[model samples]
Target: MGYIDLEYAHTCHVKSVSDVYSLGVLKLEVLIEKRAFSQAEEEMNRDLASFALPIIEAGNIEETLDRRPVPEPTPWQLHALKHVAQIARCSVKFAGKDRPTISEIIANPETACE
Candidate 1:
């Protein structure tokens, strides 16, 4: 839902971690349904970073799930969301070697399912 803006004299390369971070932010936006700027100040708080790590580690991805009741998501939908969380986490691993390659992800699509 968002695009990266990179200014450079030559080709710009984006890291997998940057992509993961962007996906995380997008996921949060969908779940929260509020303007990003509305919570910009709070988002910068160090405490939120600490809180996020535990939730990510505990597999509590559903905590960020959208609560809107327009059309209830099926179990499969929930599973898919969890899968995305896992992928995002893996892509953001501290060590680049720990991350899966784009081709690997494409070949193992089911890994994204809960």
Candidate 2:
């Protein structure tokens, strides 16, 4: 999938969050080594974008974390990941008016709390 496909789908309305969703899904796919979507109906109902919200909100970002051994990401990196998760949550809000503009998100200071 690419930007063109998304643009054609009118998905650009929440493009940034959708991009974040895609990244999160890809990361989960890599971690699980299987498409979590196929096994559970609930998972299928909620796309990757929606699926990540609860996990992130629960502050269990590491629960289904990638299994492959890799160097630990710094706290800054984890904070950045959480920030993206927050932005994605805001972006995917049902009402477009509720979504934060890119500028607003950029202006906010990063916080360590989930």
Candidate 3:
């Protein structure tokens, strides 16, 4: 459910944007070190995107980051993490038009890092 695009589900067709949404879910899973569906998560947040989007949008990405690493992320790494979250957030918008193009996603991190 977390990896599926709602638009594709209803329309019974696949689009490029559907891939973007799935990428967003994948990013969320990586960031949180959690699977797309996790029994460990709360009922409402069993879906990784649902659990993460709010935190990312709220600028509380730190709360959703995987903390198991021996040393926590540095300030610079935190900035990069925020940008990645932003990309994921844009990619997962309910309306496909609200998402960025693949080209835009590719261009973003480069510009954002500069």
Across 21-91, the per-residue lDDT of candidate 3 in tens digits comes to: 89888888877787887666356557777778888878999887888773489999898788888888877
Instruction: Put down candidate 1 lDDT per residue, 28-61, tens digits, no spaces.
Output: 4554344333335765533222334466669786
The lDDT per prediction is 0.50, 0.49, 0.78
Per-candidate TM-score against the hidden true structure: 0.54, 0.50, 0.84
The digit string of per-residue lDDT tens for model 2 on 1-114 reads: 311213325644645444433444454555434453453665544345456557767877656555465456578766655565555555544444555554555566353112
Give each prediction's root-mean-square deviation over alpha carbons. 5.9, 6.1, 2.9
Could you say which candidate leads in lDDT? 3
- lDDT at position 19, candidate 2: 45
Ranking by TM-score: 3, 1, 2
Error of 1 at 56 (Å): 2.8
